[model samples]
Target chain A: MTTAAVTGIGVVAPNGLGVADYWSAVLRGQPAIGPIPDSTYPVRFAGQVVGFEPDRHLPGRLVPQTDRMTQFAIAAADWAVQDAKLDLSGFDPLDVGVVTAGTSGGFSFGQRELANLCHRGPEHVSAYMSFAWFYAVNSGQISIRHDLRGPTGVLVADQAGGLDALAQARRKVRQGTRLVLTGGLDCPLCPYSLTAQLAGGRLSDRDDPATAYLPFDVRAGGHVPGEGGAILVLEDRAQAGARGAAVYGEIAGYGATTDPHPDSGRPPNLRRAIELALADAGLHPADVAVVFADAAAVPELDQAEARALAEVFGPHGVPVTAPKTAIGRIYAGGGPLDVVAALLALRERVIPPTVNVARRTVDRAVDLVEAPRPLTGSAALVLARGVGGFNSALVVSTRDIVDR
Target chain B: MDAFTLAELIRIMRECAGEDDQVDLDGDVAEVDFAELGYDSLALLETAGRLAREWGVSLPEEELTQVRTPAGYVALVNRELAQSGAGG
Candidate 1:
């Protein structure tokens, strides 16, 4: 079977725009979490992408039809394709597929239409309403805009679904598709989505921006919501190498599990996901040099994650980091972004530190890297567990191609 | 409201249908079918909706369904505008 290799990464993140800017910000440990500029939201703080001009990156005519989430997906996809040097004009349209993970559809667009219906009557709603709010809009719009006719889909398992989307891409590549553009992007910064998030009560009500999303810290209140996402170009390893594409890393393995009943006091079934991923990669626990944690920052959830980490890798076993703490919880975007960070980490040989974490709160066996730690390993593990006990783990490593 | 010139209709078509194809507004385009113009029903729906909202000329859905060509769309819009007592 063919292996899936990551040839390119494009990120529209709260801390930065492109991969270079984002990686640099990660290395510098920059904070993008801040108070929501719009006072209409009850949740004060969030990680909103700053200074993103849609007209600059997207076609202006389609801008009104798409939600911010779709726009982010397009922008990041464009960058990823360009970075991979994949010529869309030269490739067979049927060979390129798109899969995206979306937590919510267009919040801002839906809010406007609903407002029109409530205040100005139903007739005033824009005709685009039929297309925007559906969860598949991200993938559909990307495929339509880019003319990619291969197997296109969207996964909606909230945050952890990001890795699941990439896994689907890997499956498609292994099944014979040549290229897949896949990731997660969700913009829930608008008023309606904020109200939805506030009702869920997972968002931090903290007024201070710096301390809003202090995952694994002693006084961790909760996670802050965030916007934007990351898109990756996954191609068949031989196809990528034949095209002279630069490989970032290989999607060696992926494992998904559910906690069954997370609120029933049973420990989250995260260790199983980790073990399964490592097993799939044909590597043991000792081979994983670093780990990207979920870092939900909800007190009980954080402790549970810590204990799970301890159960699998043992005391201070692997250098664990939670860089998503800086960007807040971007729902579906969170995990894939962490995967992008992990790929970059593997490439740079430097493990990025968790932002806003002053000191380790829960006592665990995992070695939490508070500073940027340099490492010498080819493999890294990225973990994510979401609402309703969705657990996802991905194993990414240098391409292990052997020729005799 | 003045009748929608070919230019205005092209702009509306381009705006509503997205940017993949350009709307030429030339005589050849004016005589062509919407399918030949790279437009679909969604674009027509949005264009007609925008006209109703902006020009107060709510073209009937039946009339919109009959609009196969650019000339057909323009004639229907002109007739609707005449009924709304606006466009000549």
Candidate 2:
């Protein structure tokens, strides 16, 4: 099987806009969730992307029509393309593909247009309405913007779609796509979006900003929603090497499954996803030294996930952390963000603390690093489970492989 | 009911639908698209769901789909609640 390598990565998260800034904030583990400056959202607190002005990254003509989520996708894609060190100026656009996942697309834009229609009329609505809120908006826009004509697609499988998008990108790369822009962007802070999330019954209604989004804590209630995007450049290892590009990590294996009705009370299908990913990577649970958990911040969700880990690796213990806890749940963007963190953690050989996991209520057989700790294993697994059934697990191995 | 009052309802609608003219209880909703009023499919579903929770009524997906305008949405919801005793 052809191995998929992650050559470049770009992130626009609440902590920081890029990888370096985001990583620094993650290590500090401070709560970035706070009052929404947007004024239109019902929920006061959110993990907003600071200092992000879409016009700076996206061209002026393109900015007026796209939604905030699409803007994030484009900006992150630009960063990933630059990081990949591949000049698309000469490559065939057909050899490039775009795949992405997002929970709410163009919600803010749709909200704006709706307000206008309510006040003025349909004539006031912009022509961009058709494209803005579509779930595939990001993928279509990114593909067109980057001139990537290769097999573009989008995933609607809840939050698990992000990882699935990367897996699809890996397949495209193996099938001869020179480069694949893969990731997700979602901004659901608008009152309309927040009201929608209310139905999910997973949002933290605590209202008290600081304690609202505590994952794996004894008082865990629910996760606070946030918005952002992350994109990675997936290319054939040989092709990347031939161009002397910097290789970050390889996309070794990806596994996914669904639980159908997990909300009321259903066991997490994590074992199947984790085991399948390990099998796909030709590795065992023991080979993985660190784990990046989904950490949804719900008491039951955290418990189930902890148990799943214990079932797979047992009490022997591996360093497990949920860095996304600090940034809040970015919905479809969460898994890919965790993937980015895992890749960096493996490279540095140190797992970042599972921010807010300082007081672990559940007796986790795995070493729950309240603080960042050294990652001993060369391989690591990134685990994520979405509301209403989607579970995904991805394996990342260090670039340097020896006689193992 | 306080939940469906023109002012309060409009306030909630403003968040999802975007900045629109003031809405009234007797306004024509079919003339408006939920997206144009700042609500997408998910947002509208969520709003309907929230109304269900607050009003103690379950607004079916079909009922919500009929909400094309602001006043129409209120009328449909109010009618459904009255018939189903959502205001208990």
Candidate 3:
């Protein structure tokens, strides 16, 4: 089987804009969740990507056409391409593709246009609103900007969409596409979207940022909404080797399962997704070095995830971490960002700590890495769950594992 | 009853779609094609929408699409303003 190697990574997380800044902040367990600036919504706190000047990253024309989400995607994609040192001129445009996950299409843009409709008239809306607010706009905009004419798509499974997008990109690369830009970036921290999120009854209503989103903690309530995510370059392992691109890791395997109806009496099948991902990677339960948890933060959800992990890996069998506790749940962006963290963890040979989580309050069945710890294994598993019962698990391994 | 001048059109164009560095909008660009000026159909639509809001003259979509140059767009807006009895 052709393995897809991650050659480059770009991140625009709330705590940090670029890969270096994000990684440093994650390692330090710095929390970026705070009061949503200038927001009138009842949901007061969220992880906003402050200091992002779209004019600095994108051409002026693109700034108006895109929502903040797409702007983050374009900027991150540009960085990923640059990091890979892959010249578009060197490959046929049709050979390169883009796949991304998006949750809310441009909420800020839609809110403005809807305000126009309510106040002035329909004529007051910007023409860009037609495509700007569509869920697939991120993938479309990235493909148009980079002229990636090959397979292009966007998955909309909420948080799990990011890993699914990456899994799709891996399939595309294995199917002989020269290269694929995959992952997700989402910015839903606007009044309209915040109202929608609040209606879901899943967001943490706590005013204090420090205790707002405590995943896996005994005091777990709910997650804080957040903006921004990551984009990565995935190329065929042989092609990446030929180009001498730095390999971060190999996208070894992916598995996704949907939960049964809540009233159906069947338990959530997250364990099946994890087991399937490990099996697809030809890995044993003991092979995974670390588990990047979904960390929904809601007590029941957290307990369910903990139960799944404990069932699969045995009681405190493997190291588990939820670095997202620092940045909040960024919807679709959460999964890809977790994947980036996993790859970085594998590279650095250390597990980043899950902040704001008390060890004594954590589930005794799962060994939550509340502090940075040395990693002695070669593989990592990333898990994500969407609101509507979407469960996805992906296994990424050191490139040496693929080589051997 | 204010006339839509070339200066006003240039301002609206820049406000709707950012200026292209390669195209000199500050020079004699009245008769230049909007395509050459780097303002595509969507940019022109946004500019038209702004004009309707600021000038209170609704330019028809068909008439707006027929405009190929900034001068033509200015004339179209002025004609709409006159027909609506809002222009001198």
Candidate 4:
């Protein structure tokens, strides 16, 4: 089976704009969640990427009209491309592809444009409003900006879309594409955007900053919204090895399922998703040393996830944690962010802290990492579930990690 | 204006348009078309919505669209409020 190795990673999150800053903030357990100060829209809290001006990273000519989401993906993709040290002088454009996942594309732009259209008339709207909010704008922009001509696609599996994108990118590699840039980007923090999220009923509305979000705890109330994006430079491991490229971790497994409605009981879909990802990697449950559980922070949601883990890992005692709790959830970007955390954890032999969580676990039998702890491991599995029944898991192995 | 109390309702008009748009009451500011000052359609809508939120009144869509300038908007809002008998 063909393997996909993440050679480069780039990120833009509320906690930090770049991957290094993001990682450091997560390690230090920085809490970036707070009340939304913008008076235009009403939402209690959001994870906003402050001080991010899309123009600086974007070509001047294209700056005025691109959606914020596309700007994020392009910026992150550019970083990943640079980090991979790809000599684009002779890189085959047709052999490269772009795949991205987004929760809501160009939402802020859409809200603003709609506000304008409602007030000023049809002629007052910008020409770019039409394409900016479309979900596939990230993939389209990245492919256009980078000159990637192979396969291009977008997934809307909510948060799991990140891992689903990796799976699709891997499948593309097996089908013949040599290089693929894949990841997820989302910033659903705008007032109009946040109000839509408020309609979901699962959103955490804790006015108190301290007790606002608590995932996978006995007092788990609900999850908070955060904005950010993560993109990985994925290439054929064999091709990378031939060129002596820096390899981070191999995409060994991916599982995905849907639970549609929480009232239906924890459906069997997520367990099947986990099993498929394991089967794809030709590995059993025992092969995983650490489990990056999706700490959604909603009491019922977290409980359902716990039930899924119990069914899959039963008595194995694999360590589980949700590092995202430190920086709030980044919607579609959550799964890939967890993937990056998993890769780093496997590399450093240490699991990142799940901040703001009480040391007590809902299920004490499971080895949950509340605080940062060191673990000797060769492989790790990251699990994530999205609202409206999207679930995905990925297994990344450190069989090829090397210092660059 | 005291810091403790809310700023005047007309203050929103200046704040939304940037520093150069602030004007004295009864000045030509009310008559100036928003587009003439580069206040695009979206900006006008956002401004009106902000005004509605601040004044605690629902500005009907018809009245909102009829007011294309800052003064027109403020007058329309005052008229709608007076008709509802909420304020003078």
- Highest DockQ scorer: 3
- Tens digits of per-residue lDDT, candidate 1, A281-375, equal 98888888899998888888888778877888887778999888778888888888989888888888899988777766856565788779997
lDDT of 4 at A209: 57
Model number with the top lDDT: 3
For each candidate in turn, the interface RMSD (Å) is: 2.7, 11.8, 1.4, 9.3
Please give, for residues A1-404, the per-residue lDDT of candidate 3 as tens digits. 89899988889999998888999989888888888877666567888897889888877778877889999999999988888888877889999999999897999889988998899889778889989999899889889878889999999999999999999999999999989999999988887898898899998877788888888777787889889999999999888888888888999989999999999999999999999999989999999999999999888888889899999999899999999998889887899899999988998889999988774345788899998999988899999999999999999999484431
Cα lDDT tens digits for candidate 4, B1-88: 1111113444654454332223243344656776665455545555555555555456777767666766666666667667665542
Off by over 4 Å in 2: A38-43, A260-266, A399-404, B1-88
Query: What is the descending DockQ order?
Result: 3, 1, 4, 2
Model 3 misplaced stretches (Cα beyond 4 Å): A38-42, A359-362, A401-404, B1-3, B78-85
- For candidate 1, list the clashing residue pairs, or say none: A316-A365
lDDT score, candidate 1, position A127:
87
- Model 1 misplaced regions, further than 4 Å: A399-404, B7-39, B65-71, B83-88
Q: What are the RMSDs of all candidates, in order?
A: 2.7, 12.4, 2.2, 10.4
| TM-score between predicted and true chain B, model 3 | 0.93
User: What would the per-residue lDDT of candidate 2 be over residues A1-404, giving only the tens digit for each residue?
Assistant: 66688888889999989888887887777667877766454456778888999657775446666888888999999899988877887789898899898676788889988997899766456656768888899999888777789889998766788888888888898888888899888888888888888788888877677777777788788888888969999888888778887777888888998875635565668888998999998898889988888787888778778788888988636678887777778887888898888888877777888765556666556577778787787788988777668899999887463221
Q: What's the DockQ of model 2?
A: 0.02
